[model samples]
Target: MKTYTRITLSLLTILSLSACKNEEITPNRGKVKFETVSISSKLAGRIEKIYVQEGQLVKQGDTLALIDIPEVNAKLIQAEGAITSAQGQLDMAFNGATSEQLSQIDGQLNAAKAQMDFAQESFNRLQNMFQDSLVSQQQFDEVKMKLSMAKAQVSGLQAKRDEVTKGTRFEQIEQAKGQLDRAQGAKQEVLLAADERYVIAPTDMSIETISLEEGELLTPGYALFNGYKTNGVYFRFTIPESRIYDYNVGNTLTIMNPYTKDETQAKIIAIKQLAQYADITSTSPLYELSESIYELKVVPTSDISGQKFFNNATVLIKK
Candidate 1:
């Protein structure tokens, strides 16, 4: 019995020593995550030609597709013709009447003046004869009527000649010029429309998805392709809300790959204020907790030219 008690006490002492020497195990750290952005089109039309293929890389302003432009080109041609005609009309209005036209008006004015003079002479002769009792009152009245008709004809001719000599008025010339300008502007608009038929890349990005095919009709604001920058690849991670005040923009941090234990450096690019919430009953381990968090965007110092990390890649971040 004494031997049994000694053995039990010895085992208890060994268990106590082992428990004191054991170290606490640390919990595994989690990575940050972010939502992705998809790019879409601003204008829609039939896809005439595609300049890029699946998984192709493109730079900003690079032509990605060429839409049919026959209609727009035709309109542009029509606008050009209109502009030319309007310009010719404007020029004609600004220039005065030709020398031949002025000469014709002058000839009419001279003829009118001659007729008036002849009528005046005849009237005076009849008036004197009547006073000397050499002509009847009826003859004097006829001469006076002929003189009045001649004066009216002279006045009409003078007014007509003035109008022809004046050519176009300043306001008329200005109106023609305005029409020409409008035609020119229309031509420019048609040209711009034609240019818009060809869609180009907005930035140096990779083709994430292609939603349309050649000959497909698309409307404005349609999604034709999705793209993202290849070199600007970033990783987003969230820190606890309690640590939100510890970071700011342009702050530097170290990042590690949770799976491979590889380490890389990064910087804080932005922080979101809204709290992300998830249902407690949800099975998604990613959003098990509903709490406010600080979003951190970290970009690699070197170009991630050919690397494609998986979405929601687990990473370790350290200040």
Candidate 2:
């Protein structure tokens, strides 16, 4: 009877010890979470098209939507016309007066020359008459004045003709050319703005949320879509502040998805210096943290396919 009692006591103690050992071996597991960001529109216009739907996977530079660009196109065309007109004016200014204009100025100059010659001959005859006392000094003086006026008119006409024959000044031509170039540049800028109406995907991203739809008038800075990288989803988890001293960058970790029973091996890429506290009332459960927890970034060593890891999903980590 004594032996039997001793055996029974030993068995009970062993069982209790086993239970304590089991409790000690079980690790502290925490839920997995993801970070999200929202993408917004850069320009304001009507949504002409939406190329992506909710949960659609997209690569970088993919067109997401387009704005109505008819107005922009019209402005570009108008600018182009203005540029053409400016260019033609610039060309004319640079080329100077045409042959026909020069010819007309030349004829006027020749007529002035003929008038001056006739006046000079008359003045010479008057001078001879005055010297011989055949005509009065006042008559000779009148003829001399006529000759001087004709000579001055001829000189003025010759200068005017020379000006017409000379091509446009270099400075004036350059100014006109610059105006035309500016107009052309304005047209190009409008075209570029029109092209910007179409929104494009950034790269290798999955569309998480779509806010706008076709034909909707979107204002500037409107929320368009939310996206995440598709290659490998990052698992955001936190470690207890007590154990933070033991963990460092490049530390290996094991993560398990409790929902899917999927396991992934990862490494500690970063340890957030600041502590994250709980916001219990918020709808987002992942960001809500308990006190004494520090945020951590873990990148999976392997790929996860078709598995939806819930925010705050349980992960079994073996450090």
**Candidate 1 RMSD computed on C-alpha atoms after optimal superposition onto the true structure:** 8.1
Off by over 4 Å in 2: 1-37, 104-164, 274-292, 303-312
Per-residue lDDT for 115 in model 1?
90
52-166, model 2: which lDDT tens digit per residue?
Answer: 8988878778888878756787888889898999988898887788889888888888898898899999999988889999999889989999899999988898887776577
Best by lDDT: 2
lDDT of 2 at 81: 91
What's the lDDT for all of these models? 0.75, 0.78
Write down the worst ten-residue block by lDDT for model 2: 21-30
Model 1 residue 288 CA deviation in Å: 15
Error of 2 at 20 (Å): 11
Q: If scored against the real structure, what TM-score would every candidate get?
A: 0.66, 0.67
